[model samples]
Target: GDDSFDEGSVSESESESEGGQAEEEKEEAEEALKEKEKPKEEEKEKPKDAAGLECKPRPLHKTCSLFMRNIAPNISRAEIISVSGDIGLRGRVGVNPRSFRFFRRGWVTFDRSVNIKEICWNLQNIRLRECELSPGVNRDLTRRVRNINGITQHKQIVRNDIKLAAKLIHTLDDRTQLWASEPGTPPVPTSLPSQNPILKNITDYLIEEVSAEEEELLGSSGGPPPEEPPKEGNPAEINVERDEKLIKVLDKLLLYLRIVHSLDYYNTCEYPNEDEMPNRCGIIHVRGPMPPNRISHGEVLEWQKTFEEKLTPLLSVRESLSEEEAQKMGRKDPEQEVEKFVTSNTQELGKDKWLCPLSGKKFKGPEFVRKHIFNKHAEKIEEVKKEVAFFNNFLTDAKRPALPEIKPAQPPGPAQILPPGLTPGLPYPHQTPQGLMPYGQPRPPILGYGAGAVRPAVPTGGPPYPHAPYGAGRGNYDAFRGQGGYPGKPRNRMVRGDPRAIVEYRDLDAPDDVDFF
Candidate 1:
């Protein structure tokens, strides 16, 4: 009986534990179901408009930042900020130094609340002192220019030095001609005595020592010793002065080489590695080989050529990154690109047959198709490309706002000063009525002559013609009108019976008409 009781007790205890486990499992399932429904409940709770449209979070506004370029080097920060404020940009402005703390460019940063597009629109043609501010590019996207200030400064110095060296070297070449006029002939006579000791020494050193000591001489900055005292017009003193002048010429040559070396180094440091950072803001990469120490006029010419090639691109300012990328991708063939674009946007029915994508117009030839596209879709094509180029500049970022197009102001047409009671469609006051006469005027007999036909006028100072029953003389007409003859031309007195004459007088009294007698 004790064993049976114990077994029943154990079974009851196991059943109680199983019951607790089942309850816990049911609660866990319910919690999982609740968790699954949470998102659905949240979605249902979202507020809706009167029309039953779900409310979405508003898009965040972008902060406006503009890149200003071609800034004057000496322009102050306050001036830049003031310029920005003038353009309705209430924000922070700063200039980046392109040369020794002098700035050629800067940037403006504004809060998201400000409308950057409007400010940039007004920023056109903005000037800071003598420099016109160029349109800003993608400051965040483009690589920062390094050592440009030093590069530009040294470039200019090197240019001038090259010119001077070329001239001096040319003079040296011409001087070689003086060493001997013809083969085995006497040396050319100079200002100094032919047998002067100084001239002899100069000749020996220049002809004999130059080639052997060329490298050493090119590197050496050592010049002639100080001038001797009180030796005016002395041959020895004159020779010393000549020697110093020649040494000065060599010094210029040396100076040029040193600057070139410095400029070359600057060029290397100016831009990043092409493979590492391909986006160069469309700046052309130019790096000439290091020049020899004993450079001549020919090498100087080559250097000048390189300078010109580099300076032109720099002067034109940097191009967009899209253009540079296009060049890199071998998409620089403009004609091919144009053809590809045309092909994609248009439908080619056959060899010469084509249909316009825009207007659905058919063409018989490719030329005709091209013309039609140009006439119908030129502006659209340009706009699309411009937008694409703009977006392409932002390789890894959101597109920045663009400035509004500022169309040129059209000149006003010449104002029309129409008198009161006269409509624009009506004849002008000075114009004569053609092929018609006024009402209430009797018709005159035809003279059977052309427009120049002259009729017998009422005498100026005699009895009136019988044809005119009423007095129609010039004096009588003036007296009857109570005024003198009209201002310009003298009046032609006419017979009162003629309708042309009668109608002319009546028409003069018409409103909005000027009387020219």
Candidate 2:
């Protein structure tokens, strides 16, 4: 009975311990489940800020972003935002600090659906204060990025566009003023204004901003400002300004013609046979021969009167403008005017006959006048002597006789007798003999053998023998015989007269009556 009770108490204690361990494991599992659920709820609410406003996420893909490199270190996020707004960009901008101590780079991220390339193109080379921003996009979103400096390439294009706009604006203003001045003329078509909004904006900007600035500058100085002086080495600007002034002058002249003279203008026909017509400026275009139906004399006189009255004032204005420009360019208009007058007078003087300053006598030719001056006045005697000598030399050269063509003496005819010691079986040496060989010496064998003896091999042929006493290829015996004996002992021939006195009586004196001229 005692053993049984002990067993029951141990079993009850073991059951209580096992039950407590199970309860502890269940509580731990429940805690883990709650921890996982809390994170899920936080993710669901992550989009909202602390103030409950919705927050947009940044673009993480490269296709929606542009990489800007070589950004100036001093550039701030606000500047980027301003430039972006100027070009109509809607994006978030972020700058990345360079690895080393260098200029910072930046990235602009747009919505996924936006065309990144277009935005990049618009923002390319955008000026922000002193530094220009170089914007570019990588075709491959994940490719390595590099900076581009294309401002130099785009500068010319931008300048061209600005110049084109200026030209168009000038044209439009001129046309409008012309149409307004002439009530009979049709109004210019308005299609261009509506077709190009960009052009319209440019025109408006020029009229409002650029013209206002120009006028303000002009007003302050009673003329164009010193700061706006024509740039040196910039012919395009000078030409454009000159053209503008010319247009203004034309406009004034046209107004005067239309209002004061009641003259109408039209485009002249380009064909040669057509009657010439007045242009928009009321100037007639006459090409080739004048047609019969020309403007009346009275109308021309009236037009001339109007032109004089209107043109005088315009000319004065132009002169003043030119003087101002010349002053700014550090040039002297008085000197230029003097030079121009001198050149005109010189050209006119050159077209007429030359006159001697001393004698006041005119000559049709410059050479005659030069000669008269030198001969009569005795001026430039040395120069005149040189001129005379040059003429003499020219005449001498012109009259010089052609040189006589010399024909070589016909090579002496083939020898009648075979000269002693000449090679046998060969043509006579083509050289002429100085004289005949002595008689009674038979010709030698071809190979130096005795007469009627067997001949040896001929000498190895080379260049024909040099001209010897008896011509070429004649042996020593032939040369000796030609000289009438051994070498240096030539035979002398008799002459009919005394050889020493032959030239004594020859007369060399010139005749007294011979005149050189």
Candidate 3:
């Protein structure tokens, strides 16, 4: 019975111990569940003071540290501070201490309160001088910290401005003028119109807010630069002070404007009209009074007609004189005419039995007939030559002279047609070879004569015989005195024989033997 009772007590104690172990395990599970749910509740209850007015976690953005590239290597920490202030970050956020790095790269750390999205947007438009900045976020700032010097300085500046405003208000009177100054102080006017007339329409919000207390402020940063008056305005009116000398100069210049305009239009028959002047010629208009004594178009036409009438008589005289000169100069040379007649007619007339037309001599052949006409009939040949020259006027209209049928001169034989002491091979002495001597020059000495010796000449009852040198016996070598002279020089009289002394005085009716009357 004792053994049974001892085993029952031990079994009962084991059951109790087992029940206690199960209860402890259930309590441990409930405590672990409560501990896990505590962190979730804390996460749900975000602090409002973390990101300004908006409730946010401690780490507001994905990153506060920014990788700044394209930073100038020479940029100073103070300059970086000033630049951050310029980005308008002082009031809303803060920056880490010593955020600037070296070289072309740097770092910028903002406080947890900074709106990274907004800062990135503003950074895109910001340039470091001309170098654009490329800012990359490193990581979110999880710490609650504010290490910035720019925000503190900005706050100090705001406090000082407020203090200055209060001090300025304390000294003003009811009229908003300086009432504490001595008797000579200038009264500050309540309202003053702007001195510039152009800005009369524009508002002058900027006033000269000067006071004796604010003199130090004015000296440190001087008043705004004086506004430059507008130099451009309507040209038609004088809105500013005008100089009398300049006005007179302009008036004088306008007075001479018409003279320049008239010179441009002078002698231009086809001028552009007013409508086309601006676009075609670049001339707009003449700015002056109308010119006096302007001739009408009809008067101009009448003047032109009268001018043509006066010119017509001169033109007719010119034409008549030209024809007379052409006819005179066009006369065939006398020797050429004689040669033509001899070559054409002499050969034909003396073909069957040669005959000399000039001397009426007869010969056995045409060669003797030609020699007879050239030597024995030399004087008669001159008359025939003169007839040829005179008849040239009739043949002027014919393209060629009416030449008879040509027959060659008689065949050569043991015969010569030349004068005495001349060879058949020698050139004819009477005919001057063409191009042998220039006009206006003395003829070269004949083959038998000395270089300076003069040759004696005999005329064939005509002026300056064609066989002689021009002006052969004239005392002076004047090229103008003979028939063979140039057309430009005098040829009215013949020059022959020995030189004669001029008769100083003479009467038209004097006897031929008398030297003077």
Considering every candidate listed, which one attains the maximal lDDT?
A: 1
In model 1, the runs with Cα more than 4 Å from the true position are 1-206, 210-249, 252-345, 349-354, 358-368, 379-517
lDDT of each: 0.49, 0.46, 0.44
How far is 188's C-alpha from truth in model 1 (Å)?
22
RMSD of each: 37.1, 42.4, 46.6
Clash pairs detected, candidate 1 = none
Residue 486 local lDDT, model 2:
26
Candidate 3, 464-509: lDDT as tens digits: 2235455453432443333342322222122235344223465668
Write model 2 residue lDDT over 325-351, tens digit each, in one string: 434534433334433432332221355
- Highest TM-score: give the candidate number: 1
What's the TM for model 2?
A: 0.17
lDDT of 3: 0.44
Better candidate by TM-score, 2 or 3: 2
Measured on C-alpha atoms, candidate 2 has an lDDT of: 0.46
